[model samples]
Target: MVKYLIRRILVSIPTLIAISIVIFTILALAPGDPMGEFALNSGITAEVRENIRRSLGLDQPTHIRYIKWVTAFISGDMGYSFTSRLEVSSLIFQRLPVTLWIVGFAYLLGALLAVPLGVISALKRNSAFDMVLTTLVFFGFSLPTFFTSLLLIIIFSVQLKWLPFIYNDTLQLTDFNSFIELIKQSIMPIFVLGLWQTAVLMRFVRSEILENIHKDYVRTAYAKGLPNYIVIIRHVLRNALIPVVTLLALDIPSIFTGALVTEKVFRIPGIGALLIDSINSRDTPVVMSITFIYGILIVIFNLIADILYGLLDPRVSSTK
Candidate 1:
């Protein structure tokens, strides 16, 4: 297992490098000059703006600028955002935890709720329970995250007054003070994210369970006079969960994608919101830094998924 994990980690280095290069190149080629925007905003004279550009190394050729950016990145200096005038690294670090909390809670809650619901749906296939769950899953899957968030806010916050309408700050880490606050404010976003995750998980889990019930091992277990619940939980659910586990590993990292909508809607100070703001403000350094970070995260998650696959099914290691 250690050897396989090490091999996978080693292989991810080149993949991450490729991803970084592609991302950097695309951003570099994108239209809009960071210096031009700054100059325009400051109402600086052309001569002063030209001098500012020169001092900032913006006058350099694209290749030279990219080289400088990459070198700074390697040295743990992501440069400064043109708009915010703050270090890109600091900004990202500041906002990262909010997104993490939102995504993490959503993933955990969705998995916990979906798995049992899916199992029950499969167990009661063709019954009212199954029909209700199926309809719910369809509704959850069909609703977009923003719309779901709005509906939840209206019903739960505005009409019912059960929870707050939006998440403006990250939860505090001490004594769960911030956690409670986050849970209250983040309910709508979490619910939206959770609903989609639950819908997808339910469908997959039901499918996997249905497929595994026909397996020879499951038949053997049933033939041995095991209780139906025990046969299902121990003999069937264990083997059936491999695919769900794989999806879970992949889903963890993907939670950040498109989370800007939720963050903006909720007024949360998350990395997703920051990224969107940086792009709109033409902060090249921030955009590049966030892209690089996101790329690294994706590569790391992919490797993690591969390792989890091996762990969940030892046969995968031998095959690899």
Candidate 2:
């Protein structure tokens, strides 16, 4: 297992490098100069603009700039934001926690709800409860996150005045009252993100369990006078969760991406919103660094998924 993990890490180095090159090249070729905004200022002369570009190394060839950026990135420097003039790493550190708090809570909550809902649905099969849940699952799946977010805001925030419409970034949880306020602001965003993920996960869980329940091992366990719960839990659920493990592990990347939309809707200041803002402003360094971070996350999560696959199913060898 250690050898396999080492191999995967070693392999990921080249993959990440290639991904960095592609991301850099694409951003380089993208329309909009970093100096365009500066040029728009009436007080800034062309010579001054040129000097600013030179200082930032934006005057260099694309390859040269890419090389310099990559070198800086390797040495624990993420470069400064073109617009904010803040260190890219510092900006990310500030916002990353907010995104993690929202997305992480949603993910765990969705998983917790999904397992039981899926088990009940599978057990009941075509019963009325199962049918109703199935319909609601489809409804949640069909609705776009932004739409759902708005609807939630309207119903909960605007109409009922039960929750805050937008998240408060400055709200610190130093007291119980502050914590309660944070929860109130977070509820809609968490629900919006979790609903779709739960719908998807529940369907997978139901399908996998239903397929496993008919297998020979389940039947044999039942024939041996095991209770229905014991047969289902011991003989069926373990195998059924193998694929679900893969699904959940691989779905981490999507959580971050989806948080982009949810954050925008709720006006949360997070990495996703930062990325979008950077792209619009043509802040190449911020955009490039964030994109690279995303690529790294995807690779890391995929490795985790592979490791989890081995752990969940001993028949699947990790060293292989």
Candidate 3:
């Protein structure tokens, strides 16, 4: 297992390099210039602009700039953001925890709800409860995230007054004093993400459970006088969870990028919102840094999934 993990980490180096190359190439070719924002702002002359350009190494050839950026990135210096005039790494570090809180809570809550709901629906197949859940799942899957967030805000925040309408605090990374308030602010966004993820996860769980329940192993368990609950829990749910694990492993990283629309709608500060702002401002350092971080996360999460797959199912060995 250790050897496999090491090998996976090794493989990720080239994979990330390739991803960075592609991201850098695409962004470099994009229509906007990072210096353009400075040009538009008042009291900035051509000399000032040229000085700014020189400081950013933007006056150099594109290839030279990319090479310098790549080298700096490899050394863990992600460069300075042109718009914010802050270190890219520092900015990401400040916002990462907020995103983790939302993503982590949503993932756990979504999976917990999805598993039980799926099991109940599958066990009581064709019942009213099952029908209702299925219908709701369809709607949940169909609705866009931004629209869903809006509806949730309107119903829960505006009409019901259960939670705040917006989360606009200056979140500090080092402070734990505002933890309670942070959690309260996160509830709506977490629910919005959770509800959507639950719909998809439930469908996967329901399908896998229904298929496994009919297998010979399940029948043999029943024939051996095992209780229905035991058969379902030990035999059914165990095997049914493997695919859900894969889906979860892939889906979690998406929250980092996928929450852009939801964050915008809720006025929540997160990595997704940062990504959009970086893109709009054409802040190459911020954009490249975030992309690199994302690529690293994907590689790490996928490796974790593979390792978990081997652990969960002994039939899938590390050697294989």
Best by lDDT: 2
TM-score of model 2 (CA atoms):
0.93
Colliding residue pairs in candidate 3: none
* True-structure lDDT of candidate 2: 0.88
Number of backbone clashes in candidate 2: 0
- Report RMSD for candidate 2: 2.0
Cα lDDT tens digits, model 3, 1-47, are 67776777788789988988898889888897778877777889989
Please give the clash total of every predicted structure, in order.
2, 0, 0
Single out the weakest 10-residue window by summed lDDT for candidate 3. Answer: 168-177
| Winner of 1 and 3 under lDDT | 3
Q: Model 2, range 213-234, lDDT digits (tens) per residue?
A: 8988888888899998988777
C-alpha lDDT score of every prediction, in listed order:
0.81, 0.88, 0.84
lDDT for each residue of candidate 1 in 162-271, tens digit (9 for 90 to 100): 98886756445577777676567877788788889999999999998999888999889888999999998987888788878778766776555437787887777888
**How far in Å is the alpha carbon of 173 misplaced in model 3?**
13
TM-score versus the correct structure, for each prediction: 0.88, 0.93, 0.88
